[model samples]
Target: MTEVRCPLCKTVPEHGRKWDYGERTTVQCAVCGFYTITGTAVSIAERQNISHKLSAYTRDNTERGVDVPEINSNNLSQLQTSLPDYGVGDKQLLYMRALERRSKFPGSLVQVTPGIDYPLAWASGEEEFLYLLRDLLSRRLVAVPEGGTKALREDVSFETLITPAGWEYLEKHRAVSAISDQVFVAMSFSPNLQAAWEDAIRPAIVESGYKPYRIDDEPHVDRIDSKIIAEIRNSGFLVADVTEQRPGVYFEAGFALGLGLKVFWCVRSDDLEHVHFDTRQYNHIVWETEADLKEKLFYFVTSVAGKRTAT
Candidate 1:
């Protein structure tokens, strides 16, 4: 039989499974802990065609298989017979990274610090992220500090450390690693272009599922070059706006390209001729307005850097 694959991680379900209802089909993948429900056809005639349009919306008609609640031990038991076979999905990879950082500390512990560590481990605040944390607790892969309970809730803040079982699991089952989804914006921070960068470019990058960072966004006192290099090194890709023919943007793009990082070259339509001759051969996103820039950049990043998340 053909292996049933997960839509998220592209891993086959260990336990061959399927659940079919007349109007809906719910499928759970044991490999990546992915569960999704899709529309189903009731009869042979109905199965021949099915289409949903915006006009079909009704306040009384509730959506099914869409809400992801905070998953606890009880929830896990209902979903599967056992813990997932491997740590391959986004949450598992993040938890592994947080634990790895904790292991480097004097004591094997990670504090629940927002923006620094927590954001890395958990993907901000959402039911899905809380569910992942709870899943880890249920699996005995991690535990909180002395006074705290093994189960963690969304509101709680405490130090956590990976258990022995977690380490063993990591050694055996970890195959995919998380890539830094930071997209460094390299451009001339001119007063005139501030609105365009902030409103258009930055928001577009964020919508494309990557954190956008610029030198001005940081309040550090470090040397400018050092900060640029460090950010570039940590970033999965760079978006360099070469408008106005800024030397710094070119330098940053060159450094990033030399380091084998993907660079999305962009320019204002009027400034196209001003781009340096050496880099002119590269594909550039030329835009006339902010709306155009936002739309085009989002498409470019999604197409070029979409697979970075799977790494």
Candidate 2:
């Protein structure tokens, strides 16, 4: 009828297109690419179109669902009969990405290393991310309750319904294809941090022979932390580039320690100035140039097998 709202900028537009999901009317903005999904006018929800949001979330919780035989004591004996062959959820997507780019060396799954740096994947928290794809294939609505890089990951598989609507959404978006599985030098960065991070550590981390990973799963799609946690925990050594005094980095460091892996810490001097005495006093590497970070990170990371077991 009248103009709907824009998806990128949620303002009622002079002209837009209305896309309906049969039962509901979803509008897309012709001028600004904003649209409406579900019943929400969508302007109240800036950077979100109504129709797009509707596709992602249910009218209730807005999470994606999985199609598989869920495990239950009532039917435990039929495990094999229930399990499917390929349930490539987010983690498997990450693994697939890791596999795609990794060198064709034996022991690659464990040793090929990663390529992108997706903070969301890390932010998925431990339990939620551990062996996540496998869980997502079998369950639905894996959740990160705390809402940050350090929230608790809990699977909501038990309380979901597998719907064809979600599969349609996934097919249209190819959310599976967008995850970044490359290893990155993590820093609490904004636009300013990007330059500094790339300049100081990005190349070096790459030089140190790590492929970074990024997670770009659609919001309602499954976000499993299983394989991620398993990879990080089982990693022979972890290097936390603590350039920023971030709680999430500390959480990952603690996770590394809990796993009893060798942790190579790094920080910029200015940033290092702000770190707590407990962290500052620790034997962390201080690097001003990529060469130094690369030299040291490579020396340590490459020597992990000789220095530490792949436990």
Candidate 3:
């Protein structure tokens, strides 16, 4: 196997391999947040610089008797046309960009004031911003007080230190730059809840011009974790219902949060009290019937996610 390295940090990411998309050969390094675009349109100097660096690194390591794998030179021209589109979620993107902008000083940690004037809050509405913040905190991407990890409702100042996983995931998912068109729906597939998802949740997502996806819809495989991660990796946002209080649904929602994906939580009135204590701090839509879900979900998408209203 060829070993590709991040040009900026020289780290080899697991997903660092370049894939072809039409006229471009792109590489996203989750380790260093480096997204590379190369092809006929690339400048000769840039190409030469990368090639020279790789060659020099390889030669130096080889002379030192280090077992270094070389990047496959032959694969440069081979294009993988069937590669899936992997993009960063909008809310995740906003939070990351804000972090980058806010942490511009000469330090690994920074204190950010959360409010309308904040960078993250500026790009996103209040509700969405709070949800994204909770997601980041839950994922441990940013450090916060042990008890302060609950969903932020007020404008409070908090200290944040970026974690290694956060940096790599942000880079790998292209979270700071890419905009995705995928929405993941996480809910129990019980017979009674089928109508709610099809009529309310999925349709609301469709109206936002993003494709809605569910785990059960994916082909079942042995490793369910891998499939769930892959689908989240390819999605821009998530919607989860904790009505059933299923462990799998909670896991899915947590995974998405760790990845900094926007998640909308909802539950049936009777089931609301059954929701996990940790997640109870966040605001959840309490709906009685499918029609109520549809109306509320539409409003949620339009107001928080900024769905396009038809002119």
Candidate 4:
């Protein structure tokens, strides 16, 4: 195997490997992990100078052990737009979540190499990752060995443990619906939109390995508002289709967001102009046909929530 510069970060990873198969190249880099990139995407990334962001995106996903991301010209722009804009606090929380995921049990020691694991926090580099670790240490949310901090500062690998306080913090901040396999659908219930629900929304959720729960789908004796609230609380995430500019959809989507549950927004292409002004800024999957909505929604669900494990 010959040394090859990582197409995304332009750095030669010490443990990286590259394999060329006709038009696409598969690269496994210390920074970007494993990803396959098409010839067109490599050129586009260079021309747009978005390699750093792309590297972080790929690295983050790779760390999560999800489907290996393929960067092709068709989806490169969309992927760039979907890259998270994590703030300092968000990054800290993300880092903590990463640590929690790696641990087999509470207080288990998790080894980390900042240089390679920085992207787990969506951090720009090792410096920012160390800054986050320092903050966690200061807050006593995580504990290192007596001299582990100094070793980490020197860019040495070390195992850090999440303290009891860290467990408590995560428990408090964790989403109530994190364990659920149900995805709530908040959309217009008009007769005109029935086909959209049956043909696109429901099928997409099922194909993504999650149950779709819409208010009208199940019989309930409770008041509509009460049942809606209860079901939303039990949902893992939400799909809010604002095709008819429904006020209830907006309220439900907002409620889910307040609970820290992910909400995917959607709107019919023709109804795009009528979406509420406040939510206009959010990226919405605008679809011209049911087929388009089904495809996009399935992709979004699998990308964000990941496919549920089969029993």
The best candidate in terms of TM-score: 4
- Identify the runs in model 3 with alpha carbons over 4 angstroms from their true place: 1-178, 220-222, 309-311
Which segments of candidate 2 are over 4 A away from where they belong?
1-185, 196-202, 214-231, 303-311
Clashing pairs for model 4 are none
Worst 10 residues of 4 by lDDT: 171-180
Model 2: per-residue Cα lDDT at residue 208: 47
lDDT of 4 by residue, 142-167 (tens): 99978777687636799999999998
Residue 214 in candidate 4, Cα distance off native in Å:
14
lDDT for position 163 in model 3: 69
Compared with the true structure, all predictions reach lDDT values of: 0.59, 0.40, 0.60, 0.82
Give the TM-scores of the predictions, in the order they appear.
0.44, 0.35, 0.49, 0.57
Which residue segments of model 4 deviate by more than 4 Å? 11-23, 46-49, 176-236, 239-311
C-alpha RMSD values across all candidates: 19.0, 19.3, 14.9, 15.2
Angstrom error at residue 280, model 4:
33
Between candidates 1 and 2, which one is better according to TM-score?
1
Ranked candidates, highest TM-score first: 4, 3, 1, 2
lDDT of 4: 0.82
**Distance from true location, Cα of 174 in model 2, Å:** 40
